[model samples]
Target: MTTKSITIKSDRTIKSIMPPTKGEILCKVSGHPKLFLRVNASGAKLWLYRYTHPVMKSKHKLSLGSYPAVTLAHATAMRLEYEQLLQQGIDPKAHREQQIKDEHKSLASTFEKVAWHHFEQLKNKQKATTLKRKHGRYELLCSYLGDTPIGDIEPLQMLEVLRDIQANSLKDDGTPTDKADRCAVIASDIFNHAIVHGYATNDPARIVKPMLDSYRYGNRPSITTPSEFGQLMRDVETLKGTVHDSVFHSIKLLSLLFIRNGDLRRLRWSDVNLDMAQIDLQPMKGHGASKLRMVKDMIVPLSRQAVEILKAQQAITGHTDYVFHSDTATKNNIINENAANDALKSLGYQGTHCAHGFRASARTMLRHKLKYDKDVIEMALGHITRDPNGTAYDRWEFVEERSQMMQEWSDYIDNLKTGKTDNVIKMPRMRQNDIKTV
Candidate 1:
């Protein structure tokens, strides 16, 4: 009996047999030595063929590929070509795999893609700042090395970033932390995550170590001496208005608050009790927890100067709840951490001060000049210092004292802004407690 050829569309319907099912058709394609048609559940059909290596007698199969894409005529032609190759002792499958590998060679995989995917997989599994930090690293990686394929990134490329960060070495400030060893670990984690998902062949980051005894850490901008700090404050006082005076007195006041620039930027009227003259700082994520016992419900008795600055800021940007808003009607927060630094730089106060430097400036002045106890000053600045008594105690025990401390602190900062004498202001008596205690 002659075997009937399978029609591309005909289902063996005329006889008692039902239309050929997908499994039957698929099996036929896999088993056929010459030619066969397979139909899928979606009614899609394609042609496939089977061949034996003439030299090795090894059986193998070849797909003519998808229909319409591989026209019947082209498939027939390809089948004849494969037979010719088999006759010539060439393995068709090996050639196709090689072609596949070559087609992907010119493409480069980026760390950014891996970083983004890493974050996506880790979302809500960690702190929000982790997301933000990873995102920033993603941008830098993309900007700097996104064009490189995942498998091609080398240890040298990563070490160079580390060296650049250690150099503070970038602008005058040296290598930013993005190039730090810790940051390198994060970069490795991103590549490792890709390896987990099969996107990366290996993590180049793993070649770098946790800590190198001799490798210089990232360049950290430090105050180092009180005199240089004083020079910085004196220089800051000279900052004047730009075009619309985008740099205002409030931004200067914010520099003294010295919380994360973003937290200060988002400071809202709801977060502040002006009648009580206190700023209620909600503990921001990523910055270590505020250790002041006064925090949570802590009342930052606004200094006369801080209050004045707030009031002045209120009058101008009252349209929103933020005391110091940006020009773009964004939230009341200051947009640029760089704004304070830039303002300082424009005034010839180069690397000596950063917005964060204000915290150091205040802490140092409180210690040396105002004579506020270390804990009180640290608490006021949202820092938690170990109690010398060897136990965790209220860092800001004297609210009245702290209120006085903060007031003095504010006045001193205002003095610096106004070009007043360079003398460090004295802190007021640490208040024991006046009110707002539960």
Candidate 2:
């Protein structure tokens, strides 16, 4: 190999230089010591930075990059940077390797990767429905900021994501939905998990909560009056033998039981006891991030009407695990979450009554008209109403009273649908003296 001093003034000048006939040659760049343009016999040109190791005091060469890609100006700039590192007793090659290592680590610690890791840890801790919702929210955030490192995320960036969600994500009622707030909560949980595992230093989501719009609760639209509810019952009767036959049965059962939509949709045949006339459902009340935490499965006292609906439904789906099984469903074989709601919409009840509206209707009529015990009504609705000691009442505590209440409620609904005047006579409130002394 031969070395010569050459001035590479411009891009054209560098291209004009020719390679050696048999061996490689080095042309020193003007005004930058130890920086050489290496030309090979195969016509390949590369930039090399020859320097002494700051600690070892031995000469070494580092490939700056190739020519054309690494221009004359750029190669000299790298040579200057390496000289500064050598002055501070640092090896430029080792420094570059450390930076590469940090880049790889940052890629591995992205917000999306950290969030999924957190979810994996929660498999046994959270309920399936809650976990599914959390994952969906995480995905919304991941779509926007998945590539960002969790440790590098700022509060303002998180706020911007939340603002976008709040602005675009709307409900059928044309109102801002709670999806943004829920997403913020999930992001905070992910950051907290990342912090625990050393992937993040702080929770940007936690810092930005006050900056986002507060979610407002709205009552689901429902037919509150007896006449309107009776008409709904009649309208549902007209939907039998249609494509929504399963939803028709589900709607009828919703009216009779008034359970949460998720609980009813995910209801399993194994949970229904036809002989006992009750449904032992593991309610999704106290799952991940839910305020109302529950430790026991809710026991719903099935009314005669509800039992009849279940029996009819059992004949069609007894071979499947889910009572609302659908062969075309993508996830679980059960029906879609909005199946009953869509069915209600098709019945011209859109914006008036929904599948979830059944619960509110039942609560109002059962309280004002039926006059059932408040505790029994609440418990039957799968609400966790605690006693005086702060401990929740046992699911079976009000079973007998709820059974009577449920039977009465079902009979009243039947009376309404048939246009009968069988108003329930208010049961006399029992006093302490009414109880027989032992």
Candidate 3:
């Protein structure tokens, strides 16, 4: 017996169709050529479109959607769209697949997603503090272009975000121009990362550089003159009023050690070897021009003055692991990061002298005044200076020279502090012919 094909009339008629005994049955829809209601053995009614590819001249089946979910009227509209694509010499199946692929590509290329991928690459290589700062800048960028595709963001969009940061981020006196510049730099790095990884084609942030405020170049505020530095040392020795004694000692050690503020604050008693007269500092990751590969502990040859200060500090904070232990509850029980600087400000050295100025002071005097080797002084400052042959100095290079220099430096500062050094080095006077008369 032959089964007759019935035209689907309404939603009720479509739902009333019985499943075939073994396979699926396709009931044709009236007034629609290729559209039909498919009733499967499992009792699911679906819409199918039977078509011939214009290019291949072969038949193809396309599932529009399940029936009831996609009504007869909706299936008719879809069939019309497929017919339009056929008339344009396109395969409906290939077109739909291309659309899905494009959508996935777009999602993967979004600014937020791509930036996060770039950050993951950096999180392993950078220090924890450096990563924290970068994460903060990334969050700000995401606030503006989180959902935007990385390739779609233009240079103007990046500039707008930077302008907003420049205007909104305030310091005590004015806008933080340095922070705005940093944001631009970080955005450029992210875009570069995206370009390398195929998430973007161009760096929008690179073009925004000319639009940012020009950074003013000047020396870091420091008491480089010997007499001023000597007086600053004396003031630090007798520092009183409003500054905690622990903070005072921290500032003293900072001047004597001339290490970075973070390094000093995070100094552990375990890292100090008074008998060896050395500080085996771990590789500190932050802003610096040193090209030394951080493969091992940084050796800081301690001066007798530095060792004595540590011995005294051991009398107070020796029980704790950190040399600069915090009195109150806090993370790591280390002293506050700004304690040394705040003590400097309280000593009336706010703009003229800073905690970092100690490095500058030691670097200048050790090089010019005391006539120490430049490479040894740079090594003492933890900077990677190149040798005469243009090779980068190793971390442990000039160990004995640095040790002697550290001793002489401490003794020189002692002479200056006690006003016993009358042989202060003077800047060479310019000759009459060498001076340009305006």
| Model 2 / residue 150 / CA error / Å | 5.9
Cα lDDT tens digits, model 3, 1-438, are: 124387887877887788887678879888889988888788888898999999999999999999789998899999999999999999999998998987888799898888888889987687566788889888888888899988889988889988888888756566454677787888888889889977789988889877876543234578887888889999988774457656777887777778788788888999999999999886565442342423235689988998888888898899999888887734568877767877788778888989888988988887678876565665676765555556665667667767777777788888889886565433332111121111
lDDT of 1 by residue, 1-438 (tens): 123344432233211223354343442422224655555545455667777767678777777787667665676677777767778888877777787775464252456666676768777686455667767656765666676667667788876766555554243443244346556677788888867766677666667544332333332243635455545655545564462244556446755565555556667777777788878776454321232332443445677777776777777766766655677642224455456566766766565556656666667777776676666665666544344444433533556777777777677655654556366664445442222221
lDDT of 2 at 381: 75
Writing each residue's lDDT as its tens digit, candidate 2 over 1-438 gives 876556776777788888878788888787889898999888899999999999998988999899889888999999999999999999999999999988987999999899888889998886576787787887889999899988999988999999999999887777787888888889999999989888888998889987877666677899888888888888888888764667888989999998878889899999899999999988776333333544358888988888988889988898999999998786778888878888889889999999889988999889888876665666777776666556666778668778888888888888889776357645543111121111
Q: Candidate 1, TM-score vs. the true structure?
A: 0.57
Q: Is candidate 2 or candidate 3 better by lDDT?
A: 2
For each candidate, give its TM-score against the true structure: 0.57, 0.75, 0.58
**What's the lDDT for all of these models?**
0.59, 0.83, 0.78
Per TM-score, the best of the predicted structures is 2
Clashes of each: 14, 0, 0
Q: Which order, best to worst by lDDT?
A: 2, 3, 1
Model 2 vs. true fold: TM: 0.75
The runs of at least 3 residues in candidate 3 whose Cα sits more than 4 Å from the true structure, single-residue gaps closed, are 1-81, 87-136, 139-147, 151-219, 238-246, 282-288, 292-299, 325-333, 384-404, 418-438
